[model samples]
Target chain A: MDIDQILDSVSPIHKDPKAILKSYIKEVNFPKGHLLLHAQKCEKSIYFIKKGIVRAYSNTAENEVTFWFGKEGDAVISMKSYIANQPSYENIEVLEHSCFYEMNHTELQKLYNEHIEIANWGRKFAENELLKTEERLISRQFRTASERYNELLKNHPHLIKRVQLSHIASYLGITQVSLSRIRAAKN
Target chain B: MDIDQILDSVSPIHKDPKAILKSYIKEVNFPKGHLLLHAQKCEKSIYFIKKGIVRAYSNTAENEVTFWFGKEGDAVISMKSYIANQPSYENIEVLEHSCFYEMNHTELQKLYNEHIEIANWGRKFAENELLKTEERLISRQFRTASERYNELLKNHPHLIKRVQLSHIASYLGITQVSLSRIRAAKN
Candidate 1:
């Protein structure tokens, strides 16, 4: 999609579209296997994927967990660090060659300042992120690994096709061996 | 501090003081042990505490997990549900008799548009929440019960002093007995 379409996709709830869509956005492209944003860096901008895929994950001492995956028309950033103005705890890596429109923190604040519609969009995004996080937390708290895997398959089928099995295993909080067994059982 | 100071604290970040201290913001007081926001209902606005404490916890089938504790100068709400216009999964209960400015989602969005500083502040707050959640996830992954308890002690010394052991236990992903043991060991 072109810049205008991308901006339009920014939010349907926008009432003051003209004010929010300021002229600061710049579209950029990245090659596959590239790290668009690294962990431990403070993010000044949140990326909007016009055409591409990116994965957000973090490595602890023991292992890594895939926090999320972003596809076309999705927003990708290490949300916590980006919002907190602290160094990010998650690594955002490009999974495929992609095109993105960058909206830096200052620009977003400008949008928030210029238009209530933009602030509303931001509020909506925050709420969306919260729901997704809550769902992950609850699923981790209650669901069995197998159940989660099934739900993931039903909801984000493209993830299975796009991501490596190891990342999938990490995301599910299970061993690769367990995932393999599950896959075999299904077959 | 007075309302001016509060407004001042927000001005550098939100540029416009009038937009933030807008008409929707009315003063509200909660007695100790009052519920500010309830689970299973849509939260219209978030409360910004001028003084006192509030707890945000979710009720699972087996137990309740205390995830958030807001103090003076902190904003409290069923954040996920509040942002998303969905029913809240967690409830905010006032732990200390408190005074706060109650601002709903719509009014806050309006404020963000009118005041750039408020929008920046909102981002910072969201970032803080995200960082906390990431820390919680990592703590769950890497820390022992004793380690987690110690981390909590170091991070939120005041929380230990103000809240019940049961709530702390839930927050730390342990039992009250474990907290008692940890406390005993600390001494």
Candidate 2:
């Protein structure tokens, strides 16, 4: 989806569409396996994905834990780092060659201050993110591995084909062995 | 904090503080153990706590998981239900005799439409909530039980005295026996 479609999808930008587009600096192509964000760095910008897939993960003492994935038409921001202005605990990695539009934090804040419509769009975006993150957190806390896997299958079947099983396992807060057993049981 | 103070604490409200106050219906003197919200019910309103503590928990197949706690001067809502307009997966139970100011969702949305300052406040509020929730989710995902216990003790020392250990254990995603051992190790 284009910027106009995305802006309207969240909340309509009734005024100053040009200003919004200008604020987003176009990034045409980022290679696969690239790190858009690194652990311990503050996120200076939010990226709107035009194509490809991205994953967010953190390196624990033992290994990496994949927590989230973003696809086309999704906005990718490290909420803690971006909003709190702190070092991020997670890294955002591109899983496939990607194209993006980037908005610097200060520029976005400036737009929010200048335009009520932009501020409303931001409010809706944050509300949507909060809802999604809360749902994911609850699932991690409450659902069994198989239940989570089944729900993922029903909701995002494409992920099974696109994302690695190990990353998916980490996202579900299960070990690879448990995920394998669950997959076996499913068949 | 009163409504005015809360409003200014988040973002400055230059226009129509009275309307905002009118939108928030004052609710007072709720006794301990009162439930502000129940699992499976739609959250029609958001509550700003004036006094006391509140806990959000969900009952899973095995037992209850206490995921979050709110204190004085905090705004409490089931973000998933409130933002998505869905049935809540968590129950918000008051842990102490509490007083709150409530704002119905529709009224707040109306205010957001009419007032840019209100929209800015809402945006700031959502940003803060997202930052906090993201932090908590990361801790849950990556921290060891003992590390979580230690961090909780260092950050929220009053909680050790004000809240039950059982709820704290559940929040840490550990069994009560393990919590006891962690406490034993600490002392």
Candidate 3:
């Protein structure tokens, strides 16, 4: 989709406001496995995925734990790091050759200050993110590993096809072996 | 604390804007154990707790799972229900005799439309909530049950004293027996 369409999908805005927002967004591309943001790095850019997939994960002492994936039309940011202007606890890596519309934190803040509609859009976006996070937390707490896998498959079948099994396993907070077994059982 | 002070703590605003916001806020009280919101109910009021604690939980077939707690100076809302105007998946209950400044969803939307500062405040509030929910999700995925319990104790010692052990266990996604064992082990 074009920038205008993407912006409209996020929140409707008038032509002048859309033009102002468009000025701040710079399109960029990255190859697969490209690290967009690293843990312990302070970066202030939020990316709107025009195409491709990205995975956000945290590295523990023993292993890397996948948190979530962002596909096309999704906004990818280390929210805590971006909001607090602190080092990120999670690393975001592109899993496929990607195109994104990048918005610098300072420019976005300016837009929020200048436009009430943008501020409202930001509120709605954050609320949606919170809701998705809450759903993930609830599933993790209440659903079994197999149940989670089933739900993931049912909800994001495309994701399962595109992403590696190990990454998906980590996202589910289960071992790859367990995931394999679950997959086998399903088959 | 008064409504003005609470609003100030969230994000500072000019006197006139503050007065406009104050007009929409209604102070109300609920006794301990009062069910402020129920699962599958579509209500759209966000409460800013002036005094006392509230718990948000979801009821599964097997048991009720406590998701999180909100104390004095916290905003309590079943956000998904409020945002989508759909039945909530979680229930909110008063754990202590509570006083709150309640703002209806429609009034909040109107305030956002009329006041840029209020919209900015809402954006900031939502961003903070997203940060918190992300933190909770990360901990749940990465931390051990005992580690989670210990973290809960260290961060929210007051919660331990105020709330039931059962609810705390539910929040940790552990049985009461497991929580007891973990507590004993820590001691």
Instruction: List TM-scores of chain B, every candidate.
Output: 0.81, 0.93, 0.94
Model 2 lDDT per residue over B1-187, tens place? 7777776676667756556655566666688899898889988888888878899998977789999888877888877666778888789899988889887887787877777777888898998888777778888777788998999889888867889899999888888999999889866
Which residue pairs collide, candidate 2? Answer: none
Model 3, A129-161: lDDT tens digits are 778787888889889889998998898888899
Give per-residue CA lDDT, model 1, range A1-187, as digits (tens). 6656555554565434743464667789999888887788887888888887889888877778876778777777767555657787778898988999887876776666566567656655664565567667766655667988999899889878989989888877778999999989998
Per candidate, native contacts kept equal 0.19, 0.70, 0.81
What is the Cα-based lDDT of residue B15 in candidate 3?
A: 93
**Of models 2 and 3, which has the larger lDDT?**
3
Chain A TM-score for each candidate, in the given order? Answer: 0.87, 0.93, 0.93
> Which residue ranges in model 2 land beyond 4 Å of their true spot?
A15-27, B15-27
C-alpha lDDT of all candidate models, in order: 0.73, 0.82, 0.86
- In terms of lDDT, the best-performing candidate is 3
Report the candidate with higher DockQ, 1 versus 3: 3
User: Distance (Å) between predicted and true CA of B176, model 2?
Assistant: 2.4
lDDT of 1 by residue, B118-164 (tens): 66556455545555565666666456778978887787798789899
Q: Rank the candidates by TM-score, best first.
A: 3, 2, 1
